[model samples]
Target: MIHQVQRSTQVGRTTHSPKRRVTPIYAPGRRHPVGQVVGDAFIKHIAFSKHTLRSPRAIAFDVSTLDDAERAGAVVAEIHDTESRNVWTAPIALIRSKGFPVRRGFGNQWALTLEHWSRNGLQSEAEAREEQQAAKQAAASVVQLGLFGGGL
Candidate 1:
């Protein structure tokens, strides 16, 4: 004869909830828009230009240190045009004495100014030399023009 015993079993069930999504939050502060930043830069440039023009003596000293003649002349011209109605003749003379070829053209002027900065330890010597060479080449390429005659 075989005897059978009955066993009781209990099962537990758990319910799970889905995770929620979150949005990014930003702090409140003055946001500098791109246009505003550009406008500020423009205003600063204008102010600096005005200040440079007001101080012709300083401008002369600054230009005198530059090695390029054209650049120096350009600086003088810029000062005269932007800062003062009267010409800054003294600065022009100072620039001419520095072996810079007095001439027209934006590049020539920039080269002269950069040369000055280079000579004064403000710029690397190599850079200054390069600018000088470029300016020289530019000047050499220009056809000579007399007071009355056109380009020769």
Candidate 2:
């Protein structure tokens, strides 16, 4: 099923809303329990979103309400970005033997968000792979939009 919410573009062109995937928060112990944190991890903030990956800068955040979110069937982690001293929270899972996913709320593109989230704290190669994939997808979408007159 397609959700049809229409909005006017800058050029007054009508376009259907992009497909959105609402992902649950990243809890440590759903499929598997949280493993002992090895150490302070230095992971890259990676994403290829609709909006320019702005400054790729960081800022502080307060995730004081996630406990209440559990009742809604999701979990979150408040992580501080040491580089920018920013704290961020997201509804992504950090499963054992898996990568952590923290969406920057950039777009509704699930694939775009997935690569970054999965690569955020996983293997180093994850960043490169996800970034490449997201860039390709974003480029493809742009071409599609251009070809289709920006409706799809």
Candidate 3:
């Protein structure tokens, strides 16, 4: 039970009260429609460019967080652009940040933002993974020195 303290009209007096729980009024599932068009009217007024839409071919927002995918912090979204006869893949974040409303099915706004990034030329997932791996390897190869000023 949730409670709130209310100040009484009489000075130096208060009462403990329970607040009523409010339920959602909308259909539980209509929360976040994936790729649901934001429309030209809305996009045009925004700060970002609308005319320079992300390459339809390169916008693959992969949503996965299993094993290596989680370790790498992103997953490969292999989007096949049939009209262009080209396949493009981009990395989308696994753990999302705050602010974007959590969707009903898809979970949160991270994937949606990733989709926007993919449309605006985010790097390929494969390349990002490769770079991350290389960085790890380089860090591991570094020699650690002892506090005594000699290799222990």
- Any idea what lDDT model 1 has? 0.30
Model 2 stretches astray by more than 4 angstroms:
1-95, 99-123
Model 3, backbone clash pairs (residues 3+ apart or across chains), number: 1
Off by over 4 Å in 1: 1-49, 53-57, 60-65, 70-78, 91-152
Between candidates 1 and 2, name the one with more favorable TM-score. 2
Pairs that collide, model 1: 66-116, 67-116, 68-112, 69-100, 71-109
- What lDDT is reached at residue 10 by model 2? 39
Q: What tens-digit string does per-residue lDDT give for candidate 1 at 52-117? A: 323221222222223322221222322232333432222334345543433233223211232332
Instruction: Give each model's clash number.
Output: 5, 10, 1
Q: List the candidates' TM-scores in order.
A: 0.18, 0.23, 0.24
What is candidate 3's CA lDDT for residue 115? 33
Index of the highest-lDDT prediction = 2
Which digits, one per residue and each the tens of the lDDT, describe model 2 over residues 24-127?
32222234211111112211231223222333322211121132233333444334444554334333244212432235653222111233342244533446
lDDT of 3 by residue, 1-152 (tens): 11122332333454644443221111124452222111111011111232112433122112321122333222333333434434333333322331133333533322333332333356645457778999987665554334446553
Which runs in model 3 stand beyond 4 Å of their true positions?
1-78, 89-130, 133-141, 146-152
